[model samples]
Target: MALSLMLRNCPKLKGLSALSRGTFPVSRHQNFTQLVCKNRTALPLAVKCHNQFVKAIEPTRKMSADHSKLWSIEKLFSLILLGVVPATFICPNKILDNLFAVAVVMHFHWGLEACVVDYVRPIIVGPVLPKLALGLLYVVSATTLAALIYYNQHQIGIGQTFRKFWCISGTPADNEAKNQ
Candidate 1:
């Protein structure tokens, strides 16, 4: 209503409403430009000026099959873990221990990677900090995976370790007696 009233009151602006509606006369383009130049505030709403200093950034890739494959693998690992957890506890063996170690570490790495990517974004933090955080995440993930693999190879292994944790019912001597 205000716009209609404004246009009705100002004959100069009557063509502007038509221009916004796409029915602007071709001959009026020059007149519109002149009017816009004269009254900078009256520049057409549809007209946009681009800044040459700002370069357009395009996505580095259209689509990545590898990302989809990674997503599928992550989901598969998650599902496998559902069974692997119980199986490891039920029968703690070298194969199940190693499987548990690999799957758990990969699951943890993926989950932490997601957290780091989402929370430690360069836009939120500074560029340097995000890169540092990602590097730290990689280091931590690799260390954890390596340690688990080592423990599985040389020690009682992940499954047996967890089983031992559940089996702890008393003090050192009491537990030793129970085991004996």
Candidate 2:
């Protein structure tokens, strides 16, 4: 009844001579059933085609091994240093900035580690340390790095801060500030 009212109110449809011929009646339930049947018939074939395409492409895909073997303790330490050093020395804000910088570095490191464990490490040790341990380690490392950065920033003085923080040190602005 509502649909008929809507169709009646539609000025563009009212102007059409074909629509004025008569109210064309059809069963809504029958139309819906026809649409569902059409989609149902097509669905399985569509899924089969997609599965075939995926399978065909899967064999040709290559794993990226750029930092494949760089997962030792020394390398992890270096990564930590790379993240922490810049934040501690370079950032204008002390505690929070340093912590953020360290967190950013650790985040990338952890992500790379996770990818390596999931893809590369499976080929080596058959999923070492369980999934739970891996997740726990990531969370712990991130938290620890954040806390360490905050601690270091609070403990250190500005003069002892590394100049490596700014790409361009000893600029006119710095020199002017120093001169003052």
Candidate 3:
């Protein structure tokens, strides 16, 4: 019903019915826009429909100071990661290892959080599931960060671990010989 109403109101969707019914013969010469709507109406209606759709899909929100600061911080952290990653690999130590672990886990957390916020919206998957997903993300991120930190502290650091893994050869004895 809503789709039919949208089709009726939007002049551009006039040929949708014909297209659906297979009566509208599509030709290579005719552009998709031409096929969709041949209506020669004023541009205002199309603009109005577009604005309405945008408003409906994405509700406007006033950007707070904290949001702006967080955005800047995220961008800065990403830029820092570019340097931290290579530097950690080149000079693997306690400080660099811990830094690498924290940086990577935080980056992963932020990325996953963004995905959860964007895709697991209340409107799409109901209110409870979205909250639950976000909570689970936090839990997983915390656990991962804790594990990485523990590994860095207790055993070989992330950089050394990766370096060791990268140096793998045909056999364990061959690896040991190469290391020695």
Candidate 4:
């Protein structure tokens, strides 16, 4: 009777040990199959969405390519040389320089305008102040350029002039103390 009990208990204990050891593998298999099924179900939906998006953008992509090809390499180079080189080197009155400066400032202003229009809130008060400030800056830059042209025809001492223009208001002692 004891032997029968011992034999029955041994099989139960063995089964319990086997179950403890097999738990992780059985759970992992279940999880893996669940993941596979989820991915299989989602794959077709993702592919269909991607196809639809590509189809929607196809016409725009072709239009952009066609527009981009309008400016040939030779034409672009010629435009750059004609616009930039004479502005920097050949013009003696600095009119081209002033025009270039104004153009750059206007370009910056337009870029800021585009950014504000695209991303900023129409009712937000913060962007309005910055836009006004940028306008003031453009005016100041243009005025400074005009003053430079009026006062100095030759480029002599221009570096010294710039240094003086940006000179700090503090004494040399204050600069030395700050450096340390």
Candidate 1 off by > 4 Å = 1-66, 171-180
Model 1: what TM-score? 0.61
Give all TM-scores, in the order shown: 0.61, 0.31, 0.64, 0.28
Please write out the lDDT profile of model 3 over residues 1-180, one tens digit for every residue. 577556545754443333323335667888757755764442444555566566554535554546777778788889889999998888889888888788888888888999998899775688899999999999999999899889889998888988988777698798788879
For all candidates, the clash counts are 0, 1, 0, 0
lDDT by residue (1-180, candidate 1, tens digit) is 566545434654334445434333334446666656665555544352221111122213445456888999999999999999999999998899889888988999899889987788665577999888889988987898788888888999888898889977878999788879
Candidate 3 wrong stretches, greater than 4 Å: 1-58, 61-66, 172-180
- By TM-score, rank the candidates, best first: 3, 1, 2, 4
What is the total number of backbone clashes in candidate 4? 0
Count backbone overlaps in model 3.
0
For candidate 2, the clash count comes to 1
Candidate scoring better on lDDT of 2 and 4: 2
lDDT of candidate 2 over 1-180, digit per residue (tens): 567545534654333333222223335556744644655654454455556555533435376865546456446656666666566554535654555556555666666567656655443455655565667667877777776576556755332444444335677799788769
Ranking by lDDT: 3, 1, 2, 4
Superior by TM-score: candidate 1 or candidate 2: 1
CA lDDT of every candidate = 0.74, 0.55, 0.76, 0.51
